[model samples]
Each structure stands twice: as structure tokens, then as C-alpha cells.
Target: MRRLVGVLVAVGLALGVVSAGPASAAIDSSGSAVILPPDQDPFYVPPADYGSRPNGTVLRSREITALAYVMPIPVHAYQVLYKSVDGHGAPVAEAATVLVPYTSWTGPGTRPLVSYQIADDSLSTRCQPSYTLRVGIGSPTGVGSYEVSMSYQALLRGYAIVYADYEGPHSQFAAGPQAAHGVLDGMRAVLHHAPAGLDPNTKITLWGYSGGGLATTWAAEQQGSYAPELNVVGAAAGGVPAELGAMLRHNNGNLGAGLALLGVIGLARAYPESGVYGILNDRGRALFATNEDACTLDVAVLHPFDRIENYTTIADPIDSPQARFLIDTNNPGQATPRMPYYNYEALQDEFVPAALADGLLKDYCADGGTVKKVRIPFSGHITGEVQGGPGALQFLADRVAGKPVTSDC
Candidate 1:
């Protein structure tokens, strides 16, 4: 109880989210606290349980970003954040996706709210996450869309799950500060668009896995200055690389296999200032040609083991002093973090560097921000969301309930 109160006060001071109405017990539609019980399946719904459709007001799983095109198959009805217009009187593309599992509601309505969650990658249209079995795995196989799985889950829960492709159209790289803007905007788009039937002032929460974790961290941190009007009760994130610079540096040398190469190549493709092109050898250049524009997951599978092993020090011939400067600033420790973070990291992560995680956590702790770490005994480098998702959900659930997160596993 004390921890929960501390979270409210700390979050209010940190994000400046003023509570408007009386606070009540917060929770998702699901009655389960954190892990779903043995009888309940966390991901899928059985055919026998597909009963009558929800009369609740919700635009589930549909892509309403007003960007290029609205993706088909509304994931299901989730609690949306808000919506607004841009400077030119255009609709601001702000939104996030959410999934609510609830029991009998004593609240205002039966229909769940529209909501959103950010995708876990840098801004890129690359098809790495696509898969034959999964829609968002980054491979070109399968249905090649994430909404299908999201919709499948939402329907079973009788709630909506919003999928915020927060990378924006340009797929910006390492723009951590701008993360809050994208998240808030994406979430707002849903709230404003779907409030006719659902509650306009319904409770909202944010949760994410990996790259999405970074966005969640930034959104919570910058809630004070960005979209103060939105009633964002709590946000939960897992596997936070709190400091981007430290991440870059730690991964630069032979820390991990495909990760550093892919991350560096991706960042270089996004931000040229890191001198990425100059550091690559002929073999590295060939590899870059194949994957400079590829998605993170695609690089993980396609590149044979031999090609990934070549990822060594950023500067092979370290005698030259110029390369040293490039190496120094890329570490996560050197980069300054800009927001309050619900940070989590894996202890034996093959993708994320241990040194980077340690340094970033130290800094965030010093800043008096809320830090939640879920140390995975297994390596979650590949399927980060699958591994860290349950914990992420519970963390956000606590925050929305106005509780401090004590589940630091």
C-alpha cells in the first residue's frame, strides 16, 4: 500500500499528471493480477468460447492512424487515448493500441475503450517481423500483418487492442526525445476517434515490450510537457535501454553477434553523424548492402551465423585517434537520458549489452525515476515481447490502479 501511494506521488511529481476525479481501484478487464491462471490461456481464445459479440462501443484493431492507409481487421475494442488535429488543421496522427481483459464492470459502460501500444523497433517499413505463423515477426511470409493476431486476442477478451506504429512514416532512429510526442499523438487519435460509444474520459494505460519499451519510457517521462490533458494513469515497459549512447557503444565491439552489427547499421542508416559508413570493411560493406534497410528481426534470421561473427570492434586498427572518438560517444553511458522510465532489462540478454543496461539503470535511478527490472533467466534477445510481455502488463496495471510497482523480478 505504501509502495502504491509512493508511485502516485512520484509519478505526479515526475510527469505532472494532475488527478481530476476521485481515485479508485485500478485494473484491466481481466480479474487476474499478473500471470493468468492455468485455466486461462494468455494469448489465444478457444473456438468453443467465441460466444456472442460485444455490444460495447469500440473500434478494435483497425489502423486509424490517418497516415498512408488504415490497416484492415480492427484488432478488437481497446481503451483509446485521445485525438486531435495538427498545425495545418490536419488530423494529428497520434494514437496507441491497448487490450483490456475485464470481468463484470461496475463502471460506466460494458463496451471496452479503444487503445494503442507502440511497435518495438526504429521507424522502418522493413518486413523483418513478418512470419508464416505470426503477422508482426518481420518475415515476408504468413499474412504479413500484425492486426490479425492482435484482433484474435482482442476478440477472445471482448476488448480492443490498438497497435501504434509509433515509428512514424519516416521511421526515425534514436530520436528518444521525440518518442513521447509520437506515443501521445497515436493514443490521442484513437481517443478522439472512438469516444462516441465508449467513455471519452475512460481510464487509459500504456505497456510495451522492447523497442516499444523505449517509447513507453519516453512517453511517460515527457507527459508533463507534451499531452498533459490525456488521462494516462500508468505506463509499463520492459527491457529498457534507458541510455541510447551506452547501448550503441556496448554493442559496437564483439559484445553480441547479429545485434551490434544490425543496430549500428540501422542507426547509421538512420543517423549518418555516427560515421557508420566510414567504419565498415569490404565484407562489412557487403553485409550493410544486404541489411542497411532491413528490419531487426529479419537480420536476426536471414544472416548466416558466419556473417554475424564478423562483428568486431568498431575500429579494427585502433592506432588512429579519430576512430576512438567515434567509439567513445556511442556507448549508452555517455548519452544523456531525457525522461522518467519504467526501465527493465534481461541479465543474460544476448541482444542488449550488459554494460549498457547497468550504466543506464544507474543514471535513471539517480534521477529519481521509477525503475522496474524483470531479470530474465533466459535470453530474450529474439522474442523480447513473448518473454517480457506478462511482466509489462502487470506493471502498467499497477500504475493505472495508482499502485507503486513492487514486482521487480
Candidate 2:
């Protein structure tokens, strides 16, 4: 609790979100006391039984008016709180926003489903896409997550959308398996949801970039073995940090360090056995504690040239066995996906090194997987999202139509 408070206070101070609220400073939510200042609204906490339910079991649901940024489409939306598993296979409740266009599918057969995972790279639940998609206000703390708006294009393409919080109730950020489960199970929830009118065997495609890409890739890998019943057509992931260890090495002392550290902190949240706090030295521990509740921009802009070594007690902090295992365990591309994949990366990506995408593609192809690799020129990490999103959408359209995908590798 002290650690949680310290993180909230430090982030509140740094983000200027410290203010008194109508309720008490601390309120119990799901057995944890969350410090809610006036500037920061508390995110939804699922009930204890949520986790005990079967994966994809919808506990409760309500129809919501989903407003897209520039699109005037009357999107039929529903908020679903469904059962999901964690990295450890423990039960958890996760929420997803399902948006169905009023227009019918112009293509053949059933309407295609796009499980869009936004790049919700934050430890704060306020930044989750489910919260940001509503009409009321943006992220409660004003972190400004606009990725949900990007889903507008998918809606424009007439694809039924299932956007999961992905990070689960705790905002497990970069936790691979946890995010993967939320995504796959969220798809399950959307498919089984009676109001959505989706075919139980609908063609599904996973799409995301950066953090979202990590979740997409992980889900693609886990689908064949984890949830084999879901008919996933394909997956498109761009600017994926396939290996967190490689990401740490690439971002250390660079502009991406702040956002990169969030992944480290996230890994700690995901894998308690990894000893994130145990590995950190005094300065590292303090830094980690201060940024506990920090969002993507808060971390990225605040400490641009930070180095991970400065926070650790040992000479090679990430080189330890525990750290290595944690990173490797979360990294994707080891498990060959059962479907064709579209992966892209910018050659000049400043945040995620292109080599990460290249390595994943190479590994997937070597395992007899059909993969299409695209290298976006004259783009950096952030620009790659804009360049890659449309192509991924097109790929999903083709895949959903049962088009044969020829490998670009």
C-alpha cells in the first residue's frame, strides 16, 4: 500500500493532478485501497467473482454511445465485463468495448471482426481505451490517449470492432500473457455477446501497434493452443517490441528511456517472481516508486535520457538471471501462430529498434509460418503507426474475405 501511495503521490505531483475529491482520499476497491485525488477519477474495479467465472463469460454488460473523433457513424456499442485469465492462468475480469456499425457487411458471408488493441501504454486504468472511447471526457488524469480515435478508420471500413482494455483491471501495461488473455477472451466475449449479432465462428483479426502490437502478437501465438475455438483469420502487428530485453538495450539513455522503463515496471507488475523491486538499487527503486502511476507521455517526456543501469544496485542490472527470464518469457515469436501474419517496422524507428521486428519475422518464417514483413521508409517509431495502420486494415479485410496470403518474406 505504501508503494502504491508513493507512486500515486509522485505521479500526481509530477502531472499536477493532486486535488481533493468529493470522496475520501483513499477508498477500498477490490481489496486494494486506491488513492483518488480530485483530478484523477477512479477506474472501474471488477467484482471478486469476476475472476472465478469461466474465460469470456460475460458477467455484466450495458449499451454505451461510442463517439468517434471525426466519424459521424451511429456506432452500436456495448461495454462488456467478461472473465479472463492472467499470466499465471488465474481468473480475472476484463472489459472490452464492442462497436458494430449500423450498416450491414457489404462483403461476402458474415461481417468481419477486428479486435483492435489500442496503444494504451500506461500503468493508470484511466488511459485504457474503454474509458477514453466514451463521450464524457478524455483520460481522467488528462494523459491524452488518442489511439481509441484511430479505431474510427476501422469503423469507417465497416468492420465490427472489439476494443479490449487489454491491460486488464490493473493496467498491466506490457505484460504479454496477461494482455494476450484479455485480448483473446475479449474476442470471445464479443463473439458470444447475443446483441452484437456476430457469428460464433466469425472471422477475427488482431490489430495493434507498439504496446498493442505486443498484446496482438502474444494473442496470435497463444490462440492455437490457449483458445483454439476462436476462428482467428490473421493478425497485424506493427512496431512491436517483441523482446523487452532488446527494447531496454535500445532505449537506455535514449529519448525512449522513460516509456521503456514503464515496460520494466510493467513486467514487475506482470511477473512477481521476476524480482523487479528486488533487483533495483536505491536510486532505481526511488525512480520506480515515483513513476508507479505514470502514463506513457508522463514517463517519455519527463525523463528522456534516463538509463536503466542508474537505478540498479548491480553493474549489469538487466543481465541478471531473473531479469533475463522475465523478459524472455514475455517476448513473442517463440510460439508459431496458426495463421498468416502481417508485421511492419520503420527502418528509422527511434523507439522500437527495427531489428526486433526483423528477428520476430525471421523466427516465425523459419517455423513455417506465412508472414508478410513490411519496412516503412523515412519513418520513425511513432510515424510508423500512421503508415502501418491502413495497410494492416487492408490485410485484415483480405484475410476476412478468405483471400490467399502470399508471404512477402
Candidate 3:
């Protein structure tokens, strides 16, 4: 969210990098992309009982109703990172919107909603990633980032797109409710600034796959309460790695063990009670020094999971007391949602455990939450990107049409 540090974002836009022809207009003035204060535009507040929030905004329910409106889009897109509280009132980072108009129009701007896309580690520029290589990792087609596809989908539906690096630049894998705060705050920046080429009424539909699924679930659980102004219609989380605890135990000695490492790092971040941070002595600290900064989730997947084998075990990183607490927090998908939610799981997934998926489904059904459970037959975790995404779109469209949603889902 900070001014994308001029880290020379080593990755250059490749040949086929396409920004869908501008279907919108631009801002009427010059701008710093200046420094802004946190909570200048309050959205989040604590407690189920109503209370006036950050900007003296009154909350009727848990949801923060009216969104700050921004119009007259800016010529160039600009990004800023600031801190704000999540639905649970925890301080977090937010990435502001940068509107780049692709069209010319003078008529009163239509307020379009934004669909958010959570990418993997490709978000950081400090080390300069190979865009081509990163795109390939996200999509084997070697064609484009998912946002390219997601943007087209949003535009077709008459909504703008907002790509979120919910993991922040550091890529916190699954911190749960804390992640979405930034995503929603960014939506606020878009609404308040209404950068020249962007829409003023950009509502939101949180969407993601695999690693991105964490953001979708986080944002959905926070909506109707955190940033009610975003008017989040719904959310779709594909390849839901619902339970991190199961993922580690099940993935032991398997191809998916790498995810366990990512979970350790993330959970340790969100729940300090997990005891991962202090367990490691100077030796354990050294492993993180070399590994944490350079390692991506994918690269870590190639490991030995035997009790004392390799990085997979995260062997003896924390004390027994702290280790138990961290392991206990492994279940993430159990969130009691405040909005419509759908999650897809690959029955044969080597990345996310099936038991976790099944357990989450049972909890969701029992909680009386809105859900669509799609079990991918004979598929791994990524199939949902191709299959579940369209289903989610249909679900969102139905909600927008004010049509009844079937409980059969």
C-alpha cells in the first residue's frame, strides 16, 4: 500500500500484457498522490453493538453503510498504503486504488462496483520478479495473470476491477479476518479519490483462487460490518484451504508440505499466541533470514516432510508449548460469514487437504450460513479457477438481479 517503492519492479510488462481498452474517463486535475492519514475515511469499528466509527461515521449495525464517493478519475494511476482497523479492530495495511481511464466521457460518471483479485507473491517488486515467469506460475497457459481474466469478467458485468495483494507486499498467506481490512480500505481510497478514469459507485465482489482464496473468505466475513460502504454483494473462494492444521498433518511427507511452511509464517503473524516467533534460537532465526526473504510458497513445496527431514517440518522452530498453540490455530475456513459465501475444493488436491475441505463444509452447513459447495472430482486445487469462477459469477449475477438464491446449493 505504500507508494509502490521505486524498487525498479524488475518485472516488465510482457508482449501480450493487455489493459482492456479503456471503457472509462479521467480526472480533471493534477495531483502527489500525497501522504494521507489512516482512518481519514473511517470504515471499520468494533463490537456487534452500533457505534460511531473512525471518521465520526455512525454505524447502524455491524456494517458501515455509505461508501465515500470519488469521481473525475486521475490521468495516471497512483497507489498508497495506509493503516486501518479490521472488522475485529486490528490495525492493518491498505492499498489505495489508482484509476487509469481507458475511455473518454464527460457525462455524469456511473458508479461501478469493483471486483477484487488476490494474487500470489508476484506483488513484491523489491526483488524484481520475472513477470513472464510469475504469470506462468499463476496460469500454466503462460498467457496472463488471473486479473486480466477477472477484469474482463467485471467489465462485462459493468463493474471495474480492483486487484488486491491482500497478503501485503510480504505475502502473509492466511491471516484470516485481518487481511480483508486493507482490501476494503483500498476500495474506500478508490471511492474517495474517484481517480479520473474510475467509477464512483464501484461496489465490491470479493473473489480469489488458491492462495488468493484466503482474501476472499477474509473479505466476505468482514463485509456487512467492516466496510458496509463497499456494498459487498458476495464472495467466492476457490480451492479453499479451509483448515491449515489439517493441511500440515495431511501434507506431511507429501507434495503439499510447502503450504505448511507458509501457514506457519502467516499464522505466527496473525496469532502471536501460536508461539512461532520466539521459539527459534539464533539458528532458527538464521533459517528465516536466508529463507523467508527469498522463498516463495511454490519453491518451498519441494521439501522432505519426515519428522526431522527438511524445511517441511519447520523442525523445532518453536517451543512445545507455542507449537501446540500454533498448530491449534490451523483451522481457518471455519469463519462464520456475514455474507453469501461459496468455496470450491479439489477432492484429490495435494495442496489443500480434503479433510479440511469436508470439515469446513460441515461447519458451514451447521452454522446456517449461505454457501455453495463444489467438490472437484479427480482434480487438484487449481481446477476451480476454470470451473468454480464461472459458477461464482452466475451466483453474483443472480444476487444483483434480485433473484432468489437456491438453498439447494
Candidate 4:
């Protein structure tokens, strides 16, 4: 715990909250200065005519040193800024980091691609995997940096991985369609890049938990329609908030309320037409302004057990017409995935109710979609990710091997 606190203090110092110094500066393995955060980086800016380019077209490319706890990993890493569509189908530039192992693949068929989504439950571009996975001072505090360790497991297995900033340029945290487009198009950009050396016919699988799970499931549901040219074999989503409204209600006025509020901000960013900001009172507006660029740790640590009604003008803002429309539009399970699906949930999840996953799987099965379900006993939202990860990985392995999946539904 002492070491953890020390790391947090160091992060605070780097963020300029505790002390002032050369912020956002860290030495890479090559002894060069690391790239600036996305907010301050020119690479994140897309060309004005990027909208005229095809979806998934690479706008910018840069080679980056991948890191694991400040040490450089022996792998080839590249970040691509690609064109994608937002929730309303407007052109937007999204970023993704593609990692290829130094070791060659000895597995069946060509090398497999795993689009691993990191749970970037933050409102800052600095929290995206494209920035966080690089060797830099900000990496320790970047939300995706910790989860990139799990992507290394797939890299060890000779699977090329792409970590997309599925939240898009604005960091729309819970907006589903925008995330889906970003994930699918990131895969497209990776395949289109010649230097990546990935086969165009690479079998793809998706894995993520919590907010990542939300993005993975959204991509899985929309892949058939949005990017049917790509070969997506299977997907594994755990600790999923399958229904946005249900999750908001479950977490309101509880320990997860701060995170829930972040989701509201994200939704408002994705759909300004919903008028979420207009409904906010002075306190709500102030809190939103403060946390608009906050990382997951900032929200989780600073605003636990918060009540939305404390800041909003309405007693039940979630039940308002705009909120209802946002919820209905973003919720998954309206369509079934073309490939096999694996879902895991915590029976006692506090942030997202298990019944939502249960109902989603049931609906998928009824729609003739291949589905696998696992329920972790005595686990809450966080522990469910740890306990369910191995099973999810195994399920992906079977799909990659072309093994038949048995649907529990």
C-alpha cells in the first residue's frame, strides 16, 4: 500500500496537482522525450478534408515504444489516427495503437488479431490507450496503461492486438454507436496498414470488461452491419452494462454514482441534442466542468457515493424524456452478432445488474445467435473482471481454433 500511495503521489506531482515541474515529460528507452498528451499533441488533429476520406483511412501514423510499468517491452507498436463515424454518423477521427509481437505466429492459419478494448472510464484523451501504452511519465496515471498488461498476454500468444480509442476524439465515455464505429474502423485501419504485416483475412476476436465490455459488445453488435468486410469470429464481454438506464438507476446515490455521473457527461458529449447540460443546475455544471477531463481514478476516488439529484434541477433527471431517448438509443441487444458471443457477469454486480446480461443473452439466443454465458458467484463488478478473464480468454482461444461453441441459453 505504501508503494501504491507513492506512485499516486508521483502521478499527482506529474499532473501538477501536488507540485510544479516538467509536467508530461518522461524519458523513453531510447533516451528521447516522450510524446505530449493527446490534448496537447498535434498528431491527434485530423486534416480538414478527413471527412472526405474513406472511413478507417489513416490520418496520421507514428511508431511508439510500448511500455510495461515504465520499462519498454520488446515489440513493435504503432499508433494510427483513423477516420470513423460518430453516434450521429458524422465523420470523426479516432485513434488506436497496434501492437505486433517480435515472435512469429506458429498457430493455425494466419496470425490472429485481437481488438482488446481497455476500460478507459475517463473523460480525458490522455486516458486513451494510444497515449497511455507508450513509455511516458503520464502512463502510470493513464487509465489504459494498467490494462495494457493484459494485452501483453495475447501478444505473448503471437496475436497482434489493436487498442482503439473507441470513445472517439471527444472522449464520449458511454456513447455506444460512436465506440462501435471506432473499434471496427480501427480494425480496418490496422488491416490497411502495410507495415503492420497482418493478413487481410486475419481472424479477429474482441475482449473487454466493464466500460471496455460496453465498447466490445457495441462493436460486436454493429460489426455485421457497419464493417461486414472484416472477419470477426467471436467476442467476449464481461461486467457489461448492457442496459444504460438500468445501470444508472442501479448506481445512483451509491458508491458507483460518481462513475455513473461520468457516464452522463459522456452521453451528453455524444448527444448534445439530448439537452443533458441544459437540465443541470449550477452545482451540476460546476462538477461537470471540473471532471470533464478527469481520469477514472479521479472520479472513483473523488466522488464516491454521490447523488445526481444533489446537482441536478430535476428530482429524477434520468426519467426525463431526453434521458429516456439517450438510454433507448444507446442500449445494446436490439440486434444479434453474426459470430459467436461469450458473456460473463457478476451475480452481485453493484454498478450493472446481472439481470440485464441475463435478459440480453436470452434475447440473443431467441434471435438464433450463438451465445455463451457465465455468472460469477459472490463477485461484484470489479472482482468479476478478474475472475471471469481466464474463461473469456479460453473462449476466444476456442473461437480462434475454429472449435464449436456450446450455447448455455
Candidate 5:
């Protein structure tokens, strides 16, 4: 890997450039961010036997300082690359940042785990939690910063936190099964990471919001079938994009139109058989390619209020049979989670319709899952986090205390 990076650097020097255009900027790291060599870049070159390894098998681990943006925190941080599966059921390697709080558990049987998936809405390695959690490193969308701040809150409560990339090596951003596999395998990696001193049987809570909420919900729904042994106590997700079709339809012509476009790009990357690219016009292709390395802010700034229909050659790209099939396959709450759930949605959300989230809670209830649903009024997408976080934390606290959850469903 060093040799490969050296050659690339040498070539870049020959060409009088340090980084290679937008691809280099895609990860959105600072000038001081530790640059990995090409061969060693986990995002670029995964292990040859990636899918062959057992799920959750830790391929590599490196200790690093946990940071809240640029400031270091008193936590034991380990960056781990673990075995996971992709949308195609192929083996893939995923990365996550595990943080063991310096404080001890004063009120619990054991320090519970929080698989805190962040809203890393990007198809770039640089946006991965493991990368952005380092001091001086930042994601273009600032989502990483927000995630670290939230993780710090969990650290204060004596919970070990694992921030999984979830997007996998291919940066399959919105693929449900792929994200679930990455998150589950990430938990496996952290639990077995001896140095973290966590019990294998420790109870866990899956917590996330927005894009992370989508991944968290999927992980919760798949945990019974995929990682049945995990002692998950509850899942707390807010601002969930439960129905992709509804989200896309709502995002169209709204300020969040860029996210809708990016969702299509992500879906295409995850399920190429859907043939999204094949249906695209030249303008559509260019727009899609331009967003290949974009983060949240970039996407919104570049294509705010843009409609998905404007980019495709077909009358309605989202309703195409291939797209519909993939969307249905990825929608969450198909299976019942073995544990209780705390689902909250902003009634005024412009990105994901509140009705869709309500439907997800209803679907989970229908599947015999215990669900406590909350609707935060007067809150939109971004502000919903502030309004809903305290309630979610309290719910998670109750679970950590081994108290029985009172179901709203």
C-alpha cells in the first residue's frame, strides 16, 4: 500500500499537483488529516478474502485519539476493519470507530453498548466515521461533527460507542441490507476487540437519526435473522426515512431535492441491476457523476429544489419497475425486532414524510414488535434532533436500567 501511494504521489508530483481533483476532496479531510497510502486505503483496497471471513471478524485494528471535531476526548478509541456483506451477498470489509469512555459504569450491571450510526449521507470513504472522528479531520457535510458531539454525550453516560461506516467498501449509502450487515458486523468487531474490555453478552441499544436512522432501523429489523445472538435491548431512531418512495416523492421540488437525487445515485450504486444509469439522459448522467463524491451540503447547494423527474429520460424515473422493486426491498420494518423500539418523527419534516414513519411503526407493530412512537410537532428535519434527542436518551436509559418498556403500539 505504501508503494502504491508513493507511486501516486510521485506521479502527482510529476504533474505538479498534490491531490487529484474532486476525488481527493470527496472525503473532505483537513490538510493535516493522515493520508493513507493507496494500497492500504481500506476504502480502496479491501482484503482479497473479504466475504470469505466470518461476519464480524476483525481484519485489523489501530488505536487513535477520539475527538469532538478537533479537540481530543478522554476515551480509548480503536479503528477497526471488519468482515461484512454487501447488497449482493458478497463479502465486504467495513470500518468503524469504537470508543470506550474513560469513565466507569456507576449505575449499571455492565456498560451497555450504543451502535451509534451517524447520518453520513455520502458515497465517500472520507465521510466514514472512523476517518472523521480523528482530530483535525472533518466531513464535507459536517454530519461527522454532529455525530461526534452526540457520541460524546453517550460517553458521558458510561456507554461504549461504535460508529459504523455502514456504507461498506462500495459506498453503498442507502442499501438497507448492506448497511445492516456493516452495523451488525461492527458491533461484533467491537465486542470482540479485547482491548475495549466489553462483555460479549452486554446489552445494546441501536440509536440514530435521519440517514443514520434508516440504517439503524434496518439493523434492528435484521438483527433477529442476521445477528440473532446480539443482546439488543432496544432501538431508538428518529427522523427515519422509512419508505424510500415516499421520501423521494416528498423531496422532489423541495429544498432537500439534492438528497433525493443522491438517494437515487446511492440506490443505483447498491443495485446496479435496477438500471438507473441506463435510463438516465446525458444531463442526468452528468448530474449523477457530479454528485458521486458530494456530501450533504454540497448536494443541497448544487441541486436544491431540483426534481428527480427532470434528470431522467423516462416519464417518472422513481416509478420505474426496477427502481420500485429495489425500493420495496430496502424499506425497513419488514421483520419484527426481538427488542422494544423507540421511534420518533418530526411532523413537519420536509425530507421524509411523517406519515411514512408512522407507517413504519404501524408495520413493526403488526409484525409483533413493541414500538413506542413519538411525533415531534413544530420541528422540521434538522431541528427534530434537538427536540427528540432527550426523549430518545431517556428511553435508552430505561432500557439500560433493565426496566420494562411501556409500548405505545
Candidate 6:
């Protein structure tokens, strides 16, 4: 296994794919001069027998300082590589960052676990929270760094938080099953880690907004079947893109077209049988190659108000049979969540229509799931996170406190 990792590292360096930084470079609260990204980092590579390990089994772990943007957060932090499954149920190693606050848990039960999913709406591994939350490695200007503030808030409440790279190793953004498995397995890994001093039976609440919301909700729905042993009590998801097809249709040629395209690229990665590359025209191929490792802001700035037809050979690639199948397979709401769910949506959201989330909650409710729905009026996609966070946090807090919740279904 060590030999395999060394060979991989050598190949990466030879190809100029990995960071060629000094090994002795000091890693501190203030950003380091050079830090290896996940693709090049040795810790991310699992052993040859990783697939033989049980799901959520920790493959490797290292202590690191957690950071909210550039400032070092005073907490016990560790990045863990664990075994998980992809969208296809194949074993895959995933990464997650676990944070335990200095202050002890004074809450009713064992310190609650908040599996905080950051909205990594990018095609790049650099956007994963496991990397971005590390000191001196994360981009201070990136969205991942900004979202770390929410994790900081949870840490302040003495809640142990696990920020999973729920998008998986490939950064398979918007791939529902993969994301769900990653989040659940990450929670499993953290709960089992001895150094964190967490009870194995700790109550857990899932929380996220936007892309993160999609992952949280998926985990909520899949936990009943995929990770039934998890002690998840509730989930709070804000600004969810519940239906991917609807999102792509809503954003086509609009300001969010680039973001939608990124989703298409991600889906292609997750389900290669979708034949996205085969249908792409020259322009589409070029765009795919260029944005293959791009972050959310990069796509948002580069391809806003762009049309899908401009890149594809077919007039409506999104409506094609392959795309439709992928969409139906990935979309949430088909299954009922075993635990209570809180969903908040921006009524004026442009990227994801409010009606899609409404329909999703309606279905979940009709299927006998407990759901609380919040509609934020006069707020769009970006502002809805700020407006909806407090209520979501309170919902999580109530669940952690063992407060009885009435279904707003």
C-alpha cells in the first residue's frame, strides 16, 4: 500500500499535477506559503485494501488546526479519510474534517453532532471542506472559506461538527447518492474516532444551504436505508435544489447557466454512461475541459447567461433521454425520510425555483414524513442563507435538546 501511494505521488509530481512544495514548510494559523491540494496530497490516497474495510472505517487521520477563513479557530480539529460508497454503491475513500470545541458539552445529551455540509458547488477538489477548513491551505476569498463561519458558529455552541467532502473524491457535485453516502459515512467515522471523545450513540443533526442543502436532504432520505445505525434525529436544509432537471431548465440562458452547466459536468463524472462527452460539440468539449477543475465563482463569472445549446450537438441536451434518466435517478423526494426534516426556501430564488422545493416537501409530507417548511419572502438564493440560518440552527438545537416538534407538514 505504501509502495502504491509512493508510486502515485511520483507520477503526480512527474506530471506536474501535484504541488512541489518543501515538505518542511511550516503549517500554522496564518496561511502557509505552499500546501498540497487533495489530488497531490498523500493522505488522500487510500491503501490497496481500503475497499475491504467496513463503510465509514477510517483509513487515515491527521490532526490539524481548523480555520474560519484565514483565522485559526481554537478547537481540536482533525481530517479523516474514510471508506464510503459512490453513487454506484462501489467502495470509495472520502475525506471529512471533524471539529471538537475546547469547551465541553453542557447540553442535555452527549455533545450533538452537526454534520455541516458546505455548499461545494464546484467541479474542483480544492473546494472540499476537508481541505478548505485547514489552516494556510484554504482560499480565503473562496466560498468554502466563507461557509466555514457556520461551522464556527456550531463549534461555539459546543457541538462537535463534521464537514464532509460529501461530493466525494472526484468532487462529484450534485450527485445525490454519492453525496449522501459520503455525509453518512463521514458521521460514522467521526463518531467512532476515539480522540474526539464523542459517544458512539450521539444525536446528530444535518444542516446545509444551497448545494449543501441538496447533500443534507439526500443524506436524510438515504440514512434510513444506507446508514440505519446512525442516530440522526433531524435535518435542516435551506435553499435546496431539490430537482436537478428543473434547476437546469430554470437556469438555461439565465445568469445561473454556468452553475447549471457545472452540474451537468458533475453528473457526467458520476454517471459516465450518460454519454455527456459523446454528445458535446467542439465548443462544449472545450468548456468541459476548461471548467473540469473550476470552483463555483469561476463558473458563475465565466458562463452566466449562456445557453446549453451553444455547447451541445443536440438542440436540447438537457431534455435528452440520457439526461432525463440521470436527472430522475439523482433527484430527491422519491423516498421518504425516516427522521424529521426542516426545509427553508427563498421564494425569489432564481437558480432553483421555489416551486420545486415546495413540491418536494409536499411529496415528503404526503409520504408520511414529518416536515417543517419555511418560505423566505423577498430573498433570493444568496441572501436566503443568512435569513434562514438562525431558524435552521434553532431547529437543530431543539432536536438536540429532545424537544418535541410538531409537524408543519
Best by TM-score: 4
- Clash pairs, candidate 6, are 31-136
Per-residue C-alpha lDDT of model 1 across residues 303-349, encoded as one tens digit per residue: 32333225423434232233334344333333223322344566666
Residue 374 deviation, candidate 6, in Å?
0.6
lDDT of 3 by residue, 1-409 (tens): 1233111121211322221121122221233232112123232223343223342122211111111112222223444344545434655444433333454433233535554544453212211111212222222211224334444554455555555435553445566655666566656655555343454454456777766676677667666566776666667777766665555666656655545554665556556665566665564455545445323322242333532124323454333556566554434543666567777777777677656756766776677777777777877666646766677777766655555655423
Q: Runs in model 3 with CA error above 4 Å?
A: 1-78, 86-92, 96-112, 119-151, 196-202, 270-273, 281-283, 295-298, 301-324, 327-330, 333-335
lDDT of 4 by residue, 1-409 (tens): 4565567666765663332322264566567775777777899899999999989999989888888766887888888999999999899988988989888889889999999999987787877888777753446354566577766778878899999999988999988998899999999999888888899888999999999998999999999999999999999999889888888888887878878988898898889999888889999999889877777766654566678788888999889887998898889886899899999999988888889888888889899999998999999987888788889888998899999888776
lDDT of 6 by residue, 313-395 (tens): 99988899879978998999868889899999898887878888888988998899999989999999888888889899999
**What are the per-model numbers of colliding residue pairs?**
62, 1, 19, 0, 1, 1
Q: What's the distance in Å from true for residue 230, model 4? A: 0.7
- Count clashing residue pairs in model 3: 19
Candidate 1's C-alpha runs over 4 A off are 1-123, 126-160, 195-200, 249-256, 273-289, 302-342, 353-355, 378-387, 404-409
* Better candidate by lDDT, 4 or 5: 4
Please give each candidate's TM-score.
0.58, 0.87, 0.67, 0.93, 0.90, 0.92
Q: How close to the true structure is residue 256 of candidate 3, measured as C-alpha lDDT?
A: 55
By TM-score rank, best first, the candidates go 4, 6, 5, 2, 3, 1
Root-mean-square deviation of every model: 16.3, 6.2, 10.5, 3.3, 7.2, 7.8
Q: In angstroms, how far off is 374's CA in candidate 4?
A: 0.8
TM-score of candidate 2 to 2 decimals: 0.87
The segments of candidate 6 whose C-alpha lies over 4 angstroms from its true place after superposition are: 1-34, 135-141
The C-alpha lDDT values of all candidates are 0.43, 0.78, 0.49, 0.84, 0.79, 0.84
TM-score of 4: 0.93
lDDT of 5 by residue, 245-268 (tens): 888888888878878887888888
- What is candidate 5's TM-score against the reference? 0.90
